[model samples]
Target: MADFPDAAPLATKLRNTLIQYYNIEENAWRIAKKTKDTTVWRKPSEEFCGYLYKTQGIVEDVTNRIVDHIRPGPYRLDWDSLMTSMDIVDEFEENCCVMRYTTAGQLWNIIAPREFVDFSYTTDHEEGLLSCGISLDYGEVGHNFVRGFNHPCGWFCIPLKDNPRHSLLTGFIQTDLRGMLPQSAVDTAMASTLTTFYSDLRKALKA
Candidate 1:
């Protein structure tokens, strides 16, 4: 940990990504500042936590349904249109579309068509299983996020982590898990929740 004497918010990876991707620094400045406490002695900041906190609500407010309807398209919140900074910066505006939205209990109830599954699933190996369905692609992150949610915290891999088919599930940032489950909890939750979910999925699929 380097002590920032000037205590000014030096650029961060997230900010740099925002600038490099969007071209405007100010848009991410507030978030960067909030990301940490360079103001006084502080701790590590979560990757894009402030941004997630800022935009999740915006996205949530815009989200009509948790399932089919994708947003920032011709919908309620055009993230690009709404953000004044996008004009100054590139914003890239990658589509992190909504794939699945349900609680731990409701996961197996969700369905992806068999034809869709056959088309996308690439392989099943010891390390992890890779599926390639027509998902909502977000250019930045390798996978699509559950829209209007707190990112990886809400995203999870369905395969059982300990079943030799997979090692880990989601990729959460792993900052903290106190008040609310942070993004880091995704992998753990995915591993923890997988057995039950997978079994349910099997039964449901057979049903």
Candidate 2:
């Protein structure tokens, strides 16, 4: 097999792909779940057999600060509950890097811990900031952690016009947690996890 290509082109492609996903019509998505904090929608993933989930909520922070917390950096590791550990494996530029990270198990360990090496990029969007990432087949799998792949995932943070301190945060997630797992479990875990994500992030930002 040919070697994986450079990160710059791949990063650009991922950014454009995420923009396309973001621009998709609202009617295309079906409601997955709704909570007091967020509403999540799902549609068939274009990259994998799994479903692509879109989560939207109002975050109580500015767009730049919110994107800083969401992207690969110190803020993410400090606050994100599902992320157990992270490291920047390689840096392409100030806005792009390759990060290796591991997520904690979910749903009473039904979904075991998983590791991923992803090319992450943060770019300016029409609305505000877009922090996007795509999994890369790089580095050895850590012991006891299944290697998971994130197709093309990103978070778009746009500052609210009326409340500049608050921003509208939208995310697109399509992760292929490769393993012999039941489909129902995956669906349930994803929806609930995403809902909880908003709550956790809000709390963190407020702190």
User: How many clashing pairs per prediction, in order?
Assistant: 6, 0
lDDT per residue for candidate 1 within 59-118, as digits (tens), equals 111111311112223321222211111111111223222232212212242311111000
Q: What is the lDDT of residue 77 in candidate 1?
A: 23
Candidate 2 local lDDT, residue 155 = 94
**For residues 92-183, could you state the per-residue lDDT of candidate 2 as single tens digits?**
78999888999999889999999998889999998699999988888789999999999999999999999989999999999999998999
What TM-score does prediction 2 earn? 0.96
Instruction: Report lDDT (CA) for all predictions.
Output: 0.23, 0.91
Candidate 2: regions farther than 4 A off: 1-4
Clashing pairs in 2: none
